[model samples]
Target chain A: QQPVQSPQAVILREGEDAVINCSSSKALYSVHWYRQKHGEAPVFLMILLKGGEQKGHEKISASFNEKKQQSSLYLTASQLSYSGTYFCGTERGRQGGSEKLVFGKGTKLTVNP
Target chain B: DARVTQTPRHKVTEMGQEVTMRCQPILGHNTVFWYRQTMMQGLELLAYFRNRAPLDDSGMPKDRFSAEMPDATLATLKIQPSEPRDSAVYFCASGLRGNEQFFGPGTRLTVL
Candidate 1:
């Protein structure tokens, strides 16, 4: 099933901080985050695999809680380039399911300079 | 840097026409995924292949949409008797097992 993302849209100024949350009803083995600019493909940001582990990319970070089947992407000191749509893909820990991802609807973020 | 490549970045066809899209995955990547994006449905997985074999295509429309990986490097999606609703940005992604998928510049299809 598709995951649910909070804050359908957000507007922020440069250097501001924002948090986007994704929650899945089914148990998730991993969470993958990507950012997509207008007219461009989704670019990989980071992935949080194990539960209770936090991963960071430059000023962006994410945390995954396996028990709750939830993940949050944190953007600190946001830059203008950070303006885009954020999507979180979840992978179920099925026996043979390797990387089949079910993605969320995505969060639209606008960061103004 | 290795990246996925897709052919015919834009496709426009009339109703009842046939449309085909192609993709060349990154070398040595065993998994290829096909996705369709629309304003209402968001991003939906149409099909996927692993090691040149189809694993799951349950999301695809069996009647009109078909996906195939004839070789390790090539994947194709074809639509027959296309309808206006089929217009959307189609994306092809390739990746290794348990790793990040590299998406190609999508093909914007417009069926009139």
Candidate 2:
């Protein structure tokens, strides 16, 4: 099933902070975040595995709550380059089977100068 | 750096025509996925394969759509008698088991 993303769209000034949330109805084993620019393919940002772990890259970070079946992406001191559509792909159950990822509708983030 | 590559970045065809899209996954990756993106449907998983073997293709329209991985490096998605509603950006992603997937540039297909 497709995950749900909050705040379908968000506009922010450079250096501002924003949070994008993704929630699933089913239990998730991992959550993968990606950013896609206009007319471009989605780029991998980070992946949060189970165990309620948090990961970060530069000013971007994400937290996965396995128990809550939710994940939140944090962008601090956002840069103009951060303007794009962010998607969260969720994986359920163990690996080795049909480990296909179901993605959310995506959150459109616009960072202005 | 290794990256997934797709052929025919853009394809325009008339209705009832046949369209084929190909992908070359990153070396050492065992899993390949095909996804279609549209304004209404968002990102939909069409099919996926692991180690050149199809794992699941229930999301694909079996009537006109087909997906196959002939080898470890090559994967193909074909649509016969395509319709205008099939117009969308198709993406190919590859990854290891339980790892982050790397996506290709995507093939923008427009069925007129």
Candidate 3:
């Protein structure tokens, strides 16, 4: 099943911080975070593997909670370029080292200078 | 950097016509996925293939849409007798198992 994202939309100042949450009912082996600008394709940000690993890219970080079946993305000291829609993709179990991903509806974020 | 490439970045066609979108997955990325995006549905997975073999197409509309990986490097999604409701941005992504996906600049299809 596709995960559910909270705070469908958020607005933040350029230097502020924001958090986006994604929750799934089923177990997820991996969770991926991506950002998409309007009229553009989504760009991969980071990936959080199972076992509650934390992955960070620049000021963007994410944590995966295996027991809770949830993941959260943290944007610290956001920049104007961070204004975009954020999506979380989750995969069930690994299948021969490959698995299909289900994506959430995405959280729209806007950063104002 | 090798990235997923999609053809016909923008297309506008009349209803009932046929539309075809193609993708070239990244080298050695065994998993390929096709997704449709719109304001209402956000992003919906249409189909996927692993190692050139179809894994799941349950999200696709079998009646009018068909997805196939004719070869390891290429994946295609086709819609016959297209309707206005099929208008959306279609994205193609490729990745290794349990890793970050690389997305192509999607094909924007508009069915009038």
Model 1: per-residue Cα lDDT over B1-112, one tens digit each: 9999998999999999999999999999999999999989888889999898888898899999999988887999999989999999999999888788899999999999
Can you write out model 1's per-residue Cα lDDT over A1-113, one digit (the tens) per residue?
89999999999999999999999999888899999999999988988986455443666688898889999999999999999999999989746665678899999999998
Mind giving the per-residue lDDT tens digits that candidate 3 earns over B9-34?
A: 99999999999999999999988999
lDDT of 2 by residue, A1-113 (tens): 79999889999999999999999999998898999999999998988988756443555688898888999999999999999999999989765586778999999999999
DockQ value for model 1: 0.73
Tell me which residue pairs clash in candidate 1: none
Better of 1 and 3 by lDDT: 1
lDDT of 1 at B16: 97
- Provide all candidates' interface root-mean-square deviations: 1.0, 0.8, 1.5
Error of 3 at A96 (Å): 5.8
State which candidate, 2 or 3, has the greater lDDT: 2
What's each prediction's TM-score? Answer: 0.96, 0.96, 0.93
Task: Score each candidate by Cα lDDT.
Answer: 0.91, 0.92, 0.90
* lDDT at A14, model 2: 100
Q: Which residue runs of candidate 2 sit more than 4 Å off their true CA positions?
A: A53-58
